[model samples]
Target: DAMVIQNPRYQVTQFGKPVTLSCSQTLNHNVMYWYQQKSSQAPKLLFHYYDKDFNNEADTPDNFQSRRPNTSFCFLDIRSPGLGDAAMYLCATSRTRDSIYEQYFGPGTRLTVT
Candidate 1:
């Protein structure tokens, strides 16, 4: 069974507060990705964890970071969330880096920065 799960369907955080979003997959995929989507904008690829190697996008901000302690789990930590950070955080998994287009996405976590 291939499935991706994201905790806390909705979240609210104070401005400048740190928050974390988690994801896990039962598909045993080799690649896990984190995306950010704002209103009326397509999801932007923040980063990806692939087989013990972490890859960060060129434009990903320093305030955002990720940790993958193991293959099945990944976490996105926002060191100091700002109002601009309020958006839908998505987690996705793929069997291989080359098959990113075929990845399965989690329901997503909506973060509200107050």
Candidate 2:
């Protein structure tokens, strides 16, 4: 089955603290990405790894980072979460340039700032 998975479906973070969210995929996709979706708006790409080739979105905040150690695992690291960081963090995957831009998304990690 094609599926992307994100753990702890929800996360509560304190201001100025670091937090990390994890993602995994069973789809064996070559491209894996981390995105921040705030306030039901369009998902913003933070960064992604295409089979070890990392690409970061220019508009992504410096406070956000990501890594993909292997094909199946990826992570989103927040150096210091601000109040504005409270939002749904989505993990997505797609076959490398499969012609279709469609991506499979996980349930997402909803981060709450306290």
Best by TM-score: 1
* Candidate 1 lDDT tens digits, 1-114: 679999988999999999999999998899999999998899999999987899999999999999999999999999999999999999999886554559799999999999
- Candidate 2's TM-score: 0.93
* Native-to-model Cα distance after best TM-score fit, residue 90 in candidate 2, in Å: 0.6
Q: Residue 59: error of model 1 in Å? A: 0.4
Model 1 pairs whose backbones collide: none
lDDT of each residue in 46-99, candidate 2, tens digit only? 888989999998888889888788999999999999999999999999885658
- lDDT at 106, model 2: 96
Runs in model 1 lying further than 4 Å from the true structure: 97-101
Question: Model 2, which residues run further than 4 Å from truth?
Answer: 97-100
Error of 2 at 53 (Å): 1.0
lDDT of each: 0.94, 0.91
